[model samples]
Target chain A: MWDYSETVKEHFFNPRNAGAVADANAIGEVGSLSCGDALRLTLKVDPATDTIQAAGFQTFGCGSAIASSSALTELIKGMTLDQALHVSNQDIADFLEGLPPEKMHCSVMGREALQAAVANYRGEVWQDDHEEGALVCKCFAVDAVLIEETIRANGLSSVEAVTHYTKAGGGCSACHEGIEEILTRVLAEQGKTFDPAAAPPPADKSGSAGARLGTLARIRRIEHAIEAIRPNLQRDHGDVELVDIDGKNVFVNMTGACAGCQMATTTLEGIQQRIVEDLGEFVRVLPAQAMPQTTNNQ
Target chain B: MTQAPAGIYLDNNATTMVAPEVVEAMLPYFTEQFGNPSSMHQFGDRVGRALKTARQQVQALLGAALDSEIVFTSCGTESDATAILSALKAQPERREIITTVVEHPAVLSLCEHLEKEGYTVHYLRVDRKGRLDMQQYLDALSSKVAIVSVMWANNETGTLFPVEEMAELARSAGVMFHTDAVQVVGKIPIDLKRSAIDMLSLSGHKLHAPKGIGVLYLRRGTRFRPLLRGGHQERGRRAGTENSASIVALGKACELALAHMDAEKTQVRMLRDRLERGILAQVPNAFVTGDPSNRLPNTCNIAFEYIEGEAILLLLNKAGIAASSGSACTSGSLEPSHVMRAMDIPFTAAHGTTRFSLSRYNTVADIDRVIAAVPPIVAQLRRLSPYWDASAGAPLAEPETAFQPAYA
Candidate 1:
């Protein structure tokens, strides 16, 4: 469970400005029932003053999400639409002292609702639903446009970090590659490397989580190295299937013409060298047939 | 603004409080009787004797013909992994696993990993009331299947499965059968001698034992291959030094559990029913989930429409009540529990499920506190909910869903 702050708990137990604002002119809806969370934000804006006279919300999510929405309503009530538009997700999280990295997406949802509401006031298109060629995560319906914007705003550098911010790769995990591409491109634009393995892990009590992530990152690097070799094999009407990665051994299957070819040994050596170069660690690429069956399950 | 108050635990399905008697039974092993059971010295012999008694105690509870069938492991996950993996290893030709979608993660996750390792797993479906599709289970059984692992009781819904019948069907097909009876063991009577169950897995913590001790009941004469290989611990079925203190605690806990098993169906059931009825009577649009008539006596899973479960849990926590939920918010994965999803519960109620699992330790006061504390919290969250407005109109359950099953 998240170690939520007292203020977060306070706002959750006693939310402010709940329900639809009476005679509200601007309304923003974000999230969906299928995604397991949704928010409807209504703003009572004074046209003459260009300020939000009142704000109310209806949120269907976890405790942190509810608290974040409550805090967002409290933060935006007295601000002009222009000023409220500048309220970042970080600001919402800061208002709550902090939300767990796993729950930072709640604050992001609050920011998205604000942007959508302000756009509603201006009669502008606020794309929260899936757009043509824009959806990146089909499971959660997260879009690349929103993913890019969130990555830039939060300075997220890892796929997991992006998930904690936008919930892009939190479901099915098929979109992790899509999220990784966006994170790399955005972090590159910021002149930063998207390597969470090198960065200090968030202050979670699970002290070994950072080292565990390092292992995961290394495994991902190994998988990518094999992927890079796939095109080389595919060009010759043959394919290599990654069977298993057991410690320093990378078990793979060379199917099609490459299966029993005389050059298989040299090919395995080449793959082994590529893995070593890519990971800066020793590893042997052995054929799947050579994988010993004695390695029992535990 | 008030500090959290004294907690009334109703999350026994998650884990139970260790009984004081069980703790006392374990204390001497931790401090004085510390020698290894395998050691040859007198101190070790004494501990080894205790270990034998512990095994018999566990055996008596499980009603296994022999104490040797009980292979102690680190936890229920290990026990489950051992039973399933050993089944597959015992029959190298069979590359498939048959299990239910509503299984605890211990079995479901292992099956998933096995799938990646080139194993075909058939996750049989469950109906809306948490009943497994018997036709689906029968169809999924074949020569390619190595084992059929089903839970005796679901952790979330407390709905009982027809494991005895399932085991019989599997045996006729010449396939091994295992039941994750972790939630069912102490809550109900088990006479394993008369059953066709080939293996069973259970945890200590679920039945008032200290954590880290579990039993993988491998029926005698079942072909076995150990998941953990090492010294001849658990008669070469499991490895590593025995968790002496916890094992002793589990033995005592099992004995105590056997003594109070009847109370679970009576006293605990009464408290559970009262809490369920009180909450449903006052909280509109709330209905129970799972097998209505065939559920465990101590579990109540209610879905309060329009309010998210985490919000309910947080407010319940403030009221000094402890329960669990099937909502995605509580799960590490950003989806509702697969059990809930497999049952095809609508999004409206799926995100709103709150589970209150009781144990024999609970009293009328605890149930009364939960009953009194829950109605307002649901109301408050509903009032805060955007869908609850009269103008918007709360999305009510279909008549079929609102027909609360015969369950608590």
Candidate 2:
């Protein structure tokens, strides 16, 4: 089961604006029954002030889609047309506390319908169609621009947040590394940098010169060498992620089908040791578990 | 979850409980009359007579002219494979097969594998209610078509297909026709002699007999090949040890079906209708799938648009009410059912599709329990959704019409 947030669950169960509108200003219908979910959103707009006076919806969908419509109605009621138009899918998700990463698209659908409804009210087309952009998640039809924009707007601090916003790396997970790279590039473009060196140093480092390769220059050298070896490991049905470096011990996390395989220890001993040796004898390569559980958990 | 005093057996479509009469008829086979039907001894000859009597009972139920046409197999899937493979083998020159989109996986997957092996396979589309398009089916049938396979009734939606007409069309084109009548047998009348159907398959479990027993009826003079190759247990058509006990049980079950056909048609239909109407009326946005006019008297496929079928099934199981989902086979994938997709049913509604197949054991009270329990569960799942806001129930004005030309 998808780990739906309490707020999402609350809105789903007790949806605010369910049913059809009797006399509404503009209505929008998005998605199809064949597509697995459909929504019929009706709005009663105040023509004098151009504000949404009332909203009602009749959705033929799952709990998430219904809740998304319900949350959308609640967000738009009493708000001006412009305010309602700016009510992003992210805002809807946040308003509902949080939604399952996969069902985030349902919230996005709600937002799309709202924009289309508002456009209908203005008697104009809402043309945000940048179809030529690179596809971010093909399964959900999400694009790269949308993912980057969502990340920037939401202050997403982790890969999980990016998943919640754009639904990237959720399906197939073949694009997880690409999503991570895009996220990192987006963060860099925004002048935000993540430096592992900024973390507090470990306290129990009382060892000889062989174990005391803690100089910043040595650390940078090891980082460069590990980066060079990363691609080769990835090609051999494995991935190497930096856990944390404490003194001469360079910690890396191996993943994929290799994570818990019988060959994992051999990989660490032979493959990882050779890479570490290339960096210098001072550097000791270790698995992620070599560090204390509490220290690594962070 | 309310626990019943005894374990409620609600998955009747999967298998059914053996009626008392069927069990009594099989008692002698398990003990007193344990003899090989093929043996030359007097005891074996008596067992052979019993087998002949059973064959006649099966023939009478199916409305077939002769008992020789009915060839007993080990199971439904095996019978289905036998029918399709036999058609392909007999007409080796014709490498094309045509079937409907809503056929059970037993047929659909086999056709798919055949396509991978350089054979052309056409899957005719079905409407939203799971009805096949006859014109499209007829168009797909050609001289190159080896067989045209279609199900008599859909297991999920209970929608009846025009099998007789389809069979006639296939026969006119000199192609074989097969129907997996597993869901329809004993529930509806089937006249094999009157229809142009060349082969038909039926399973024992669906009609309250033990599993591992099935029957395939091949029309006389129809070109065919046996699927199995070993000792000739089923007249060299199916080889291996005979499931004598289960076959006896199935024969008795067929007898009971023939005796109780009239009452089953009326009573089960009434219970099914009541269940369908009650659920639709009580729940918001709930609707039934399949042709309302032509359907199984004891089956209803409903979509309570929003809640997942697994959640509903779990809740129903807790309440001692059994049900199945159209998306049950594709569970964990979160994809809407392939059947619903082919029919153009919306994905949101497709995930919510549930099937309730009734039997003689079900009562009006059972339907009432289902009607009472399902709405609340739908409401509960809807509440957890971010899409619905319960507090915003105030009425809104109707939107002005923005009518576009219907053709455009």
Candidate 3:
């Protein structure tokens, strides 16, 4: 399940300024039904004062997307067109506390939709739809120009990050090489080196994002695994005690029948499997005797 | 330390709640019985005996002739990888594979990886009803095809494939065949003894067992190679120490499934039908996906027009209803489900598809709550949808079926 922020859930459940502005003159739309997410932003602008009077939005997307759209409307309601134009996708994200990296595209869509709405009010052509880059991701119909622009804007360095920002290379994986080339070119222009390994390859969202799990969550996961495994050891009149975690290696003390058991290696491996498989951590289960210096270390 | 209680869970196809019986059966292994089944000591002997019984239980569930046919693995993906890779290794002379376009990621991702390694894979497409084109399957089978790995039932649509017929054809073509029967094993009965399927994969979690336990049923005398080659476990068919607790849980889960199979076909089906009928009646422009006559009794996939699936699911979540979506946004992908795409389901309808999969644990009140919850959720999302208006009557699907090219 997505760890949607409470504010996001709040805005999604009880959105502010939903539906169209009753007397709105300008409307902007982004995304297609085929894209699986779209937003239409309507604004009621004051012609004489040029200050924004009201903003409303209708969104067709996930909870975060709806929340982002709602946040976009709320933020731009009292701001001038120029000020609203300055509201970035990150600002919308910050407004909602945060969005999952994979769902950053939702905020991007909100920003684009807002910009398009502002441009429509000025009777100016929308720049977002006028880009002429070749299609980079056939799955999402994302274009090369957009991918390169998003990479430069977000300072993205990896295909996975590019996917988060631009929805490029998120499907079929046929466009990952293209995304990598774009990332390399953009990062080189900014004089920053692009290391593919720095952000890992494209994986399912949970595995890729789990790389950032906090130490508390990580230890809790270890405890949960041990809790599941300790029952058997306890039933056998044995137990495994967690001693210390030194980076990737976890030290544990085996007591009772497990201390001198012939299959202690196998039992440790079993515990390791439980921790490493779904927990998305690079961890090793080692005997406390394997590393005796942890007690003396800070 | 506490939060909202888990709501009415309808995402059983994604993963079922582990049965209490399965939990009770496996708990002893975690505490007092954590012995390596391979040990020569009394502890090992006792574990090994329990493991043998678990194997027999799984064998009985599938109605297989011998218990030795079942090889335990970590999950359905591992079993799938093992079966497909083994087929290729055992017949290195053959470099081609045939599978459906709508297989679970376990099979589809592996096939896509194999394609990068210069192996040819024929991804057969399904019709509008999520039925595979038999002619395509027959045409794909040849001397060069090492294996035909089609899922017995699609996870998204719950459409059953003609695996028995496909397996027979592959056998006559001198090719191995495997089926990812993860969704079919417990929802429906399987008599492997009467079929020619060379290998089959089933996940424990889908059938009320905990995750991380699965079985690959390789027909006796079939040439095979181990995916994890190290230990003498699983008769050397798979390597690594046995996940004894989960393996035992899978055994008890299978036993319970065998006992409840009839109820799944009858009572569960009735609940699913009522839920479907109720929602369709209350909601406008809603259409059920997949074949009506032939599908898993527990699955009901409905598309609410003019609204996105994730938005509907979010509203349902607020109503304490748990369901899954085929929408691209829900999957963290750019395209909707490959199953929906392959079936030429239009983009307008495809992105709105929501799946409700039940288990025997569900009750009439659970269905009633869902039926009561969904129409309002759909109405709420449709009200928020840009394309939807209160006065609008219905919506039409996009005409283009060319985006996801059909298997020609």
Candidate 2 regions off by >4 Å? A1-298, B1-3, B6-11, B27-35, B40-47, B328-330, B392-408
Q: Measured with DockQ on alpha carbons, how good is candidate 2? A: 0.09
Better of 1 and 2 by lDDT: 1
Docking class of 3: incorrect
Q: Candidate 2 at residue B84, lDDT?
A: 93
lDDT of 2: 0.73
TM-score per model over all chains: 0.76, 0.62, 0.77
Give interface RMSD, per candidate.
9.7, 8.2, 7.8
Model 1: per-residue lDDT, tens digit, B26-79? 999988999999998998898898989999999999999999999899889998
Per-prediction fnat values? Answer: 0.43, 0.11, 0.51
- Highest-DockQ candidate: 3
True contacts kept of 1: 0.43
Please, what are the lDDT tens digits per residue for candidate 3 over residues B135-204?
Answer: 8888888999999999998888788888998889899998898999999998999999999998999999
Off by over 4 Å in 3: A129-298, B1-6, B391-408
Best candidate, TM-score:
3
TM-scores of chain A, one for each prediction: 0.47, 0.48, 0.48
TM-score-superior candidate, 1 or 3:
3
